[model samples]
Target: MNKIAIIAACFIAPILILVTMGIMYWVNHNTLVKLDVACDSQFAEIDNMLKRRADLLPNLVNTVKGYAKHEKEIFVAVAEARTKIGSAKTVKEKSLASSMMDKALGRLLVVVEKYPDLKANQNFIRLQDELTGTENRIAVARTRYNEAVKKYNTKIRSFIGRLVAGGMGLEKRDFFEIENPEDKEVPKVDFES
Candidate 1:
């Protein structure tokens, strides 16, 4: 009886430790993966919002063109930026394209400000309001994405978490950061009357 009890205890001890470790690893790994997915989804939402803004820009440009045909250069710039945004393939590329479009659109707005008629046009005003709202949403989504990424990255770098991430073949993801010279400068909008 004594020998049997000793044998049982010896076998069960290592098994219990292994089970506990496995459960801990699994829970931690799952949590990190969830965070990563949240980050990715938020970024996708931001991208979609940017695309929506870009889609609206062409119509806005065309409407302004009807009122101000002489501003051909600004119109062409807006068109080119929109095209670049549409063609963007990666997150980084999309960020650059968005920045470019912002600059072009700012220039267009400045030009539009010169013509009081364009500013007062019902369609133009409505589109402008919509675009502003979309931009605000994009900004909020970006903030959320950054927070999720920070949490995920912190977990990935932790000792045991790093081991688990490596075992799962998870790699670090890059944020959609814009560090270009053009992105650094605020879009010049000469609203001077």
Candidate 2:
């Protein structure tokens, strides 16, 4: 009501508002950066698991090759898929390459089905076990990476977060999704007779 009181209210109100806004912006920006780092870390875990699976493939291929020499096409396809996975630079590319591997390995497993002796081979058994373990690790890593991406994307797209993210130039991250609907089902790697 008084002149000095009104003047003080007007002056202090804007400073309080500005300080609150600055704090909110800082918090939002930090959240976005932290989510982004989490996405990167989880993706690295996926890459490591993929590399482990890739390493197991060759030995498995060799073991299968000793018995199924005539299945050259499947062997070649597996090799090419492995190469694509290694050379992939983006999330989509990696997903496609993984799908390719799944298809190729499925065919390879079908070939193995015809050869009873190969299934019983100790070397083949060991390689299959290692490959199975690697696949499980890959699945876990992929799930975590996707969860991180979901959080990051949600933050960047939310109303309040979008404003802060836009000012920070933050972008949505891609999920490690299955390229094909059929690929959603993991290929069974059972070697039991």
Candidate 3:
């Protein structure tokens, strides 16, 4: 009886330990996968929002062109940035192009600001409103994407997660970070400048 009890304890202890380790590894791996998926989906949402904004830009540009034909340089810049965004293949490229679009659109809006008549145009106002809403949605999606990336990166960098994540082929993902240097700079508040 003593011999049987000793043998059972040794076998059961190892089996229990093995089961616990297995479960922990699985849970961690699954969590990383979920986070990865969330990041991808959030990026896609941002892309969709950006696409919506891009799609609406031409009409806005045309409406403004009717009022301000002299602002051809700014219009061309906006068009070029939009084309860059359309042709971008990678996340980094797309981010850069989107930033360019923002700057170009900012210039366009500033130009548009000079003309109250254009602002009052029903179609221009509607397009501006839609672009603003789309920009807001893109911001939301970027925040969510960063959050997902944070969670995923934290997991892969943690103790137990580090142990199994490499074996499972999980890697750290990048946040939807701002790539444009100008975007990082604080605008001069001095109206005198």
Candidate 4:
């Protein structure tokens, strides 16, 4: 209505709009970053679990070797898989290596089955328990990693998040999917007590 009132309205309205937009942008950007960080954190957990499993392999191999000295192929397969896992750099590389290690470990378990004493040995039993626990941990960690990746991927692909993520250079991430059908099989560890 009045000159001063009109001038104040013009200045304040734009400022308020600009401030609101700035806050919205900040929130969206931060959400994207936090989701990305969560995915990375879960990936680290998977890597650590894999490392723990790898550490137990050598001892288990030696213990079994004492009983099944002729089973050199299994030993070599496990050794090579462990080496591949250690040398892996990316998440995908590590995953493929893990699958290789799993197949090798599965074959080793079969060899142990053939030797009743090796299967019953106290040290072997303890190592088996530890390896089983570690495998469970790896499974859980991979689940969490995939969940985080799913959330992050959704955020980057959705409408509002897509706009923000694109401006921030964020991209969708792949889930920790098991590509090999053989790797999906449950390991045969059950035996009559």
Candidate 5:
């Protein structure tokens, strides 16, 4: 009886340890993957909002052009910025393009201020409002994405997570951060005048 018990213990001990380790690894890997999916979804939402804003730009430009024809340079810049933003393929590229578009749009808005007719145009005002709302949505989505990435990165770098990730081929994900964060200051548009 004593010999049989010892034999069973020797056979079961390593197997139990391995099974527990496998469960731990699976749980960690699944959690990380879930977080990554959430991050990707958030980024997609942000991209959609940006695309909405981009779609609105041409109409806004056309409306402004009708009144501020002399500001050809501003109009051209806005159009070019929109084109670049539409063509951006990666998150980093999109961020840089978005910042450029914001600057160009700011300049366009400044030019629009000189034209009272453009300022009061209902279509222009409506499009501006829509763009503003989209920008707010983008900001919220980006915040969520960054938060998800932070959680995922923290997990993958932890002790047990490191082992799990290494065995499961999981890698850290990059946050969709602004390229030139300091340059993101959108010029104040005082349409009150």
Candidate 6:
């Protein structure tokens, strides 16, 4: 009877340890996955707002063009920046492209200042309002994305999470960080020219 009890104890101890380890690994992995998904979803929202802004830009440029026909260079630059936004893939690339768009749009607005009539045009007013709202949405989405990245990075760097992440081949995600200090400022929209 004593021998049988000893054999049973030896078998059950390893099984219990293995179950506990498996559960711990699973819980950690699931948390990491959830955080990763949240980051992706937030990035998608940013992308959507960018596309919305991009779509509005052409109309805004065209409306301004009717008033200032000789301003070909600025229009071309805005178009190029808009193209970059579409072509950008990675988070960093998208951020830089967005900055380019902001700069181009800023230059375009400078041209708008030269013609006060364009400022009061109904179409221009509507497009400007839409772009402004879209920019705000982009800012909100970017903040959310960065927050998600912070949480995810914190988790992966944690003691147990590091082991689980490394074992599962998970990597750290990039935050939607501003590469240029100038890009931190929202493009000013002063229609009072």
lDDT of each structure?
0.85, 0.90, 0.87, 0.90, 0.84, 0.92
Residues 1-193, model 3: lDDT tens digits: 9999999999999999999999998998888778778878877887887788888989899999999999999999989988988887666887898899999998999999899999899999899888889899989988887888788889889999888789888887777778988898987766785
Q: Please state every model's RMSD to the true fold in angstroms.
A: 2.5, 3.1, 1.7, 2.9, 2.8, 2.9
C-alpha lDDT of candidate 4 relative to the true structure: 0.90
What is the descending lDDT order?
Answer: 6, 4, 2, 3, 1, 5
Candidates in order, TM-scores: namely: 0.87, 0.90, 0.92, 0.89, 0.89, 0.89
Residue lDDT tens for model 6, 94-180: 999898998899899889989999999999998999889999999999999999999999999999999999988889999888877
Q: lDDT at 101 for candidate 4?
A: 93
Q: What's model 1's overall lDDT? A: 0.85
- Where model 3 places Cα greater than 4 Å from the true spot, the runs are 189-193
Give one digit per residue, the lDDT tens place, for model 1 in 131-160: 899889878877787787788888888888
**Tens digit of per-residue lDDT, candidate 5, span 87-132:** 8877788888888888898888888879998889999999989888
Q: Using alpha carbons, what is the TM-score of model 5?
A: 0.89
Select the stronger candidate by TM-score from 1 and 4. 4
Better of 2 and 4 by TM-score: 2
Candidate 6 regions off by >4 Å?
A: 1-7, 184-193
Query: Candidate 5 regions off by >4 Å?
Result: 167-169, 181-193
Count the clashes in each prediction.
0, 0, 0, 0, 0, 0
Write one digit per residue (lDDT tens) for candidate 4, span 134-182. Answer: 9999999999999999889988888878989999888878777775787
In the range 1-193, model 2's lDDT, one tens digit per residue, is 6999999999999999999999988998999999989999999898888878778889999999999888899999989999998999789998898889888988988899899999999999998988888889999999999999999999989887999989887888789988989877765666694
lDDT value, residue 156 of candidate 5: 85
Query: Higher-TM-score candidate among 2 and 3?
Result: 3
- Winner by lDDT: 6
Which window of 10 residues has the lowest lDDT sum in candidate 3? Answer: 184-193
